[model samples]
Target: MKAKQIRLATRPNGMPTYETFKWTEETVADPAQGEVVLKSLYASVDPYMRGRMNDRKSYVEPYEVGEVIAGGVIAEVVMTNSTQFEVGDIVIGNLGWATHQIAHEDSLRKIDPSKGPLTNHLGILGMPGITAYFGLLDIGKPAAGETVVVSGAAGAVGTVVGQIAKIVGAKVVGIAGTEEKISYLKHELQFDEVVNYKSENFQEELKAACADGVDVYYDNVGGTVSDAVLRLINKYARIPVCGQIALYNLEKPDLGVRVQPNLLVNSALMKGFIVSDYGAHFEEAITDLAKWLKEGKLQSKETVLEGFEKLPEAFLGLFKGDNIGKYLVKIAEPSE
Candidate 1:
């Protein structure tokens, strides 16, 4: 059978264009013993993928030119040789940018569609969800009644981080870029306050919003907004540096905002972490996330694209902050 795949055609300097990728379909032998043929259902588009597009040293290695771009995907087993899974079973794994994947059964984690939407497995219950869980709880360590601030508050990781902080009894304030997103965070998600970073007086507004000062800053966008937030952090405040999407497109890293010296005066704690680094604690985090999700204490959103061919467009949207939540590409319909 043949499978469609998107491969890196060239390394992108800033914002990637369609020319940077080439999509093609190729035939491959059927699954080998202990392997399954999976039909991808959804693919996640994350900020980290931008780093992988460059040939640079990062928490993860960059994707080589002429290679298939990798990412988390939700799929269904259409054929299997392993006793661990059978035909029509749903699963999630790092299946890259292909409509079909052939791999050992162990490479996929069986998922129960009855638990929730299959797409949730790629969003709230997936890597982005896990990142928010550990990044906020382990790194930020918010206390009850303490003021917690989150940048990129409407994005996948940021939304979860802010809501989780509220569940833990912290006064949550969110920073997003649009009026619609700001309204959603305040009215729908119930954040204590929502600030539009694009506003003319964003800095002054942030100060007025957090009258008591911020105890924990869950930073997803690191630029001028973060620089302003840093000025208001309480002594010994914690900053969990989950991402720097604001500067991901910069050709020179030095041109990005500088925030180190502020940490010195406030005696603050700032740390950069990769969610994969806390793999051993994933079960614990997921257990809590699932409970909160079921109990209505947590909420998730996804901006989905209809076909696998739109993957590049969906990915480029991340850098422009055009997506409202977890950006996902639906490659195929899920099995009933």
Candidate 2:
């Protein structure tokens, strides 16, 4: 089979553009013993992938200049030389940008199509859902009747964080970019309040939304938005620094409002974490998330772009704030 892969052509100086990616076609090698020939069903586009584009050491190593861009993918076992999986098995893994690829059996985990739609593996049942699960519950530790504020509140992880706070009996206030996102966060997700950071009186609205002050702040976007949220946090507030999408494209470190004084005055506890930090408990988190999903206590939303060729467009849309929840590309469906 021939597969097309997107490679990093040039590291972005500011925001990534078409020039940053290069596509190449190649004949896929047959899977060796203990391996499987996989065809991608869907691929995930996430904000964290932006940091991997730059030449810097982070929680994960940066992608090589000419290497294939790889992240989470849901795929079908097209052909298998391994006893671990059959030809029709659905699996999920950290795979390449190619539509079809080869992977060792150990690198992929089978997904039961009976539990949910296959796209769930790329969203709620996958990394983003798992990230929200641990980041909010373990680190943020929201308690009942507490005021829980989430930044980037309508995106994948942020949306789940806000909904989970509601499940924990906390008053949920979500900060998003647009009125549409605010409506989805408030009306659809049932958040107690939703504030648009793009509004003229953003800080004032946020303050009014959290009259009791913030107890658990799930931060997905940092920089000035964080500065505002930090000012309203109550004493002993818990902050989980999940993502700093605001600073991802910047050429240099941001030197804006110093929040150390806010932390000091409020006696707040803030910690930065990569989702892999809780790898040992992923199954536990997924189990609970799946239960909540099945019970209708949670909803997984995604903006899916069709065709593998549109993957770049779908990815670039993340920085543009074009997606409401998880953003992904549906390359193809399994050939059943």
Clashes found in each candidate (C-alpha, N, C closer than 3 A):
0, 0
TM-score of each: 0.96, 0.98
Predicted candidate 1 versus true structure: per-residue lDDT over 1-336, tens digit per residue = 899999999999887888989988988568888998889999998888888988889888889999899888988888888899999998898877999878788788999877888888888888899999999999999999999999999999988998999999999999998888998899999999999998999999999999999999999999888988998999899999999888888877645456677788889999999998999988898788888999999987889999999999999888777787799999999777
Clashing pairs in 2: none
Candidate 2 ranges with C-alpha deviation above 4 Å: none
Candidate 2 lDDT by residue in tens digits, 1-336 = 999999999889999998899999999998899999999989999888898998888888999999999999999999999999998999999999998899999899999899998888778878899999999999999999999999999998998998899999999999999889988888999999999998899999999999999999999999999999998989999999999999988888899888889999999999999889999999998899999999999999999999999988999999999999999999998886
Against the reference, the lDDT scores of all candidates come to 0.89, 0.92
All candidates: CA RMSD (Å)? 1.4, 1.0
lDDT of 1: 0.89
Give the best candidate by TM-score: 2
What are the runs in model 1 whose C-alpha is more than 4 Å off? 255-258
